[model samples]
Target chain A: MLTIENLHAQVEGKQILNGIDLDVKAGEVHAIMGPNGSGKSTLSSVIAGHQDYEVTKGNMLFQGEDLAKLSPEERAHKGIFLSFQYPVEIPGVSVTNFIKTSINASRKAKGMEDMTANLMLKKIREKSSLLEIDSRFLSRSLNEGFSGGEKKRNEIFQMAMLEPKLSILDETDSGLDIDALKIVANGVNKLRSNDNAIIVITHYQRLLEYIVPDFVHVIFDGKTVKSGTKDLAIELEEKGYDWIKEMV
Target chain B: MEFKEKLLDSHLAFEERIDLSDAIHQTRLESLKTFEQKGFPSRKDEAWKYTSLNAMVLKDYALFPQTETTIQLKKVKKYFLYEIDTYKVVFIDGVYSPFLSDTTHDGLDVCLMSAALSKAKYRSLIDTYFNKIINKEDSLTALNTAYAQEGAYVYIPKSVVAEKPIEIIHFSTGKEKALWLQPRNLIVVDQNAQVQILERHQSLKEHVVVTNSVTEIYAHQDAFVDYYKIQNDLSTASLIDNTYISQEKKSNVRVHTFSLGGKLTRNNLNFCLNGQHCHSTLKGVTLLEDQQHVDHYTLVDHASPKCESHQDYKGVFSEGSKGVFNGKIHVDQLAQKTNAFQQNNNILLDDKATVNTKPQLEIFADDVKCSHGCTVGQMDEDALFYMRSRGIPKKEAKALMTYAFANNVLESVELPILKKRINKLIAKKLGVNLGFDL
Candidate 1:
């Protein structure tokens, strides 16, 4: 469903991703793991069309569409979602309104009318229940004073609402407790389908234990240095990243 | 001659026309003298440093309109808060339009300022409350006071609650080439009385009209007053609104000013808490684009002990628009245990759009809590990107952000219909229909 060849990207004057190649078919979960500043988040941002990162070389294709030519919103309209590592705090926008707008926006881009209020509300109720979110939580300002766990949960709830074809979870477990992490993972597991794909990007193998990936790619420095199965994640968990640095 | 000189030269003719009693006539004469001495404020003045009236005052405007222009009720119905029944005092081209007005005198008075000044029944209320709290030294207030005639006069009797809100609307018909207007309003809410008032200055057609309006509100013991000012007019029009409120023991007064239009707008909102346990709430939302400019100068005087004041103002500017906010809070020595808070936040959508905001606090009391903060910035890029990545286009995302930034201020609006109207107006100002009722 998605393909990248020798993808090279940079932000400002420095290169973040260089000579990286990846391929994922439908129904596959790909895990991208690296230490801090290993271009893990940069790769997600590059794919999501963040204007700051300039793709200097190579090409990315999603469903045969040139991904680099699309804006962030266009990428979203094409069923690409990025669960931010750090969600922004918008003080006056309610969660329900934000999600409604997001859904209607994509619908409008697809030349469709707005979703009926009743249908939208029904979908919101179903998704919020699936994510174990309180109804009151949907009415409050989006992430204004939300706890760390609540922010991540809200992101997952949005992903559930959008039902994107490809979901990028960048460090979704960093700020969650064990119970919240389990709940979040359960919600993600329920959203998985045979036609959709998710790229779980993390530094540790803890999240892999819950949402086990079919493929694991270790990115070192600015390139993907190794590709393996889930066993590699357990191996790296025990040995740490020193061995990967030695190989590089 | 300059506009100031024209105003000074025309006062004699203006005085000859009004039914001026001795006391009121003397006050006007004194105010005219003050205006003549000070003329218009200059950039050198500390309070006027950021805003200059030189461009506006350079050209001459007609002191009085040439004709008695009348507008049909249906033609200007949209300007009124007609969704709900309101007692309206409407004016056209500086002259009262009796056919367009719905004045009342049953138990409470919601009529004209001319009647209050000339008629014997309302003379005592006028004498006691009119011009009582205005800053006589200020040139613009003095100018409005000098030409004060024919505006709204609302008197709520003691312990009486006005059954309906009052709307004071001044509509300029563009009859003259360039017109200048001075409207004086007197509102006296007696002890335990409650009232809500909405005021606006609108230009019916494209014309150069400048309205210098002064309003004095007296909130007696236990009284509650809500005042809303709408400064959305044509680009050729301008408004200088000077509103003063004096609150007694346990009185609550709140003022909300929405500045969305006009070429040059300046708002001077002053509050004086005269007794203990008084509460003052002041909030505003300003949205400007093009070459428009708006300045807000606010002062809250805490004269008695145990008083509280809350002020919040938010502004959004795009293009070459400009904005200014100078908020000052003064706590007297005897006014202990006072809590005064002021906040001003602005977003500049364009690099050329500028805002100068300052918060000043003068506290003489030892045991008081007073805090003020001001911020001027552009929209958060990360927030913008986050919204865009959620599939909202850049323009719609910006509109939503600006709307959300100003939505909190509207939450305190007690009138639901008016809030909805302002909601539509803000969305229209941002040029987006977010597909849902905010």
Candidate 2:
């Protein structure tokens, strides 16, 4: 579903992602784990076509189309979703209204009619129920004064609504407690299907136990040095990333 | 002749029409002298620094329309808040249009200024509240006072709540090549009385119309007064509005100004708290585009102890439009335990747009809480990106953010229909269709 070949990216003349390559097929969950400053977030940002990051050497292809050629909104319309580590707080726009606008915008870009109000309301109700979000919470300002748990849940709620082809969860488990973490992981697991792909980017292996991945890649010094199954995550958690750093 | 000289020479012709024997005529003569002495304010003046009236004052406007012209209500019905029942005191070319006006005297006085100024029954009212709060030193207020004749006159007796809001609208039909209008309004809410008023100045067609208007309001003990000014005229119209309000013990008064259009507009709003526990609120929202300009000058005087005042003004400028906000709060030495807050925030849509904001606070009391904040910035780029990543276009995202920025001030609007109308105006002004009602 996605391919990255030797992706060398930098921001403001400072190289962050150096000679990184990865590939993932449909219906498979991939976890990219690394220590601090290991370029895990940069890889996710590069895939989402952040304008600040310059792809110096390589290209990212999603469904056989180069993402470098598309604008952020264009990429989003093309089914690329990046759940931000820190979401923005728009003070006066309600979550429901914001989501409706986003959905209609994407549909408009794809030359489709806007969803009717009734249908939009039904879908919001159905999806919000899955995330255990109350209707009152849906009417509040988008991420303004929201708790960390609410913000993470709101992110997954948006992912569920958009139903993107590739969903990249960037540090989605940072601020969540054990209960909130399970709810968020359960949400991601439910949204998994054969036509879609998931890439979980995290610094720790705490989230791997909840949403078990098919593959785990350890990135060190901007390169994927180790690729293994779920047991590698347990071993690294027990032993720590110092040995991995030494090996690299 | 120059505009200032012509105005000075037209005083005799103006006085020939009104009663000179009345005692208030002495005040008019004095104000006319003051206007003659001061003339028009120049850019050198600190208050008029950012706003230049040179271009507007250079034109030769007919101080009075040559003839009386009538208008059809059907043609101008949209200007009024016709969605609900309202008492309308409408004017056409500085003259009251009886056909379009619905002034009443049923318990409360919703009538004409000309009547109140000339009638024997209202002479005491004219003497008590007329020209009482206006600062005679200012040339613009003096100019309006020198020609003050016809506007709205509202008087609520003690403890009486007005059933419907009064709508004071001035419409200048493009009959003359260019025209100048001076409208004076007097409102007095007696003890425990309550009133709501909405005032607007609209020019029907593209013509040079400048309205220098003054409105004086008196809120007695325990009285409530709400006033709204809607300045949405054509590109050829300009307005200079001077409003002075006086609040007595425990009175509450709020004024909301919405400036959306016009060539150049200036609002000088002043409030004086005369007794203890008075609450005053001054709020405004300015949205300008093209070469349009709007300046808001507000003052709140805390003369008594334990008074509270709030001032919040927001502006959005696009293209080469210009905006200015000078908010002044004065706490006197005798006014102890005064709480005053002032905030002015502006967003420049493009690089060419400009805004000059200044908050002036003069505090002489030791026991006072006064804080002022002023900010001028563009829309947040991160917020824009967040919206765009959600699939919204950049233009729409910017519009949504601006709408949200200006929506907080609208929360204090008590009239639902007027609030909706202003919301529609803001959206249309921003040139976007928001997904939800703002």
Off by over 4 Å in 2: none
Query: What tier of docking accuracy does candidate 2 attain?
Result: medium
Query: By summed lDDT, which 10 consecutive residues of candidate 2 chain B come out lowest?
Result: B429-438
DockQ of 1: 0.85
Candidate 2 lDDT tens digits, A1-248 = 79999889999999998888889888999999989999999998888777788999987899999989988888889998989888899988889989998999999989999999999999999899888889999999999999999999999999999999999999999999999999899989999999999999998899999999999999988888899998889888988999899898
Put down candidate 1 lDDT per residue, B1-438, tens digits, no spaces. Answer: 777878888987997888766348778888999999998999999999988999889988988777788788889999999999999999998899999999999999999888877788776777788899999779999988888887899999999999888999999988888998999999999999999999999998899999999999999999999999988899999999999999999999999999999999999999999999999999999999999999999999999999999999999999999999999999999999999999999999989999999999999999999999899999999999999889999999998898889887888888888888898898899888988666
User: Number of backbone collisions per candidate, in order?
Assistant: 0, 0
Candidate 1: pairs in clash: none
At residue B194, candidate 1 shows an lDDT of 98
Q: Assess every candidate by TM-score.
A: 0.99, 0.96
True contacts kept of each: 0.81, 0.68
Looking at candidate 1 chain A, the ten consecutive residues that score lowest on lDDT are A17-26
Model 2 per-residue lDDT tens digits across residues B50-132: 98888888999998887888898899998899999999998999989899999899999999998888889998888888898
> What residue pairs are clashing in model 2?
none
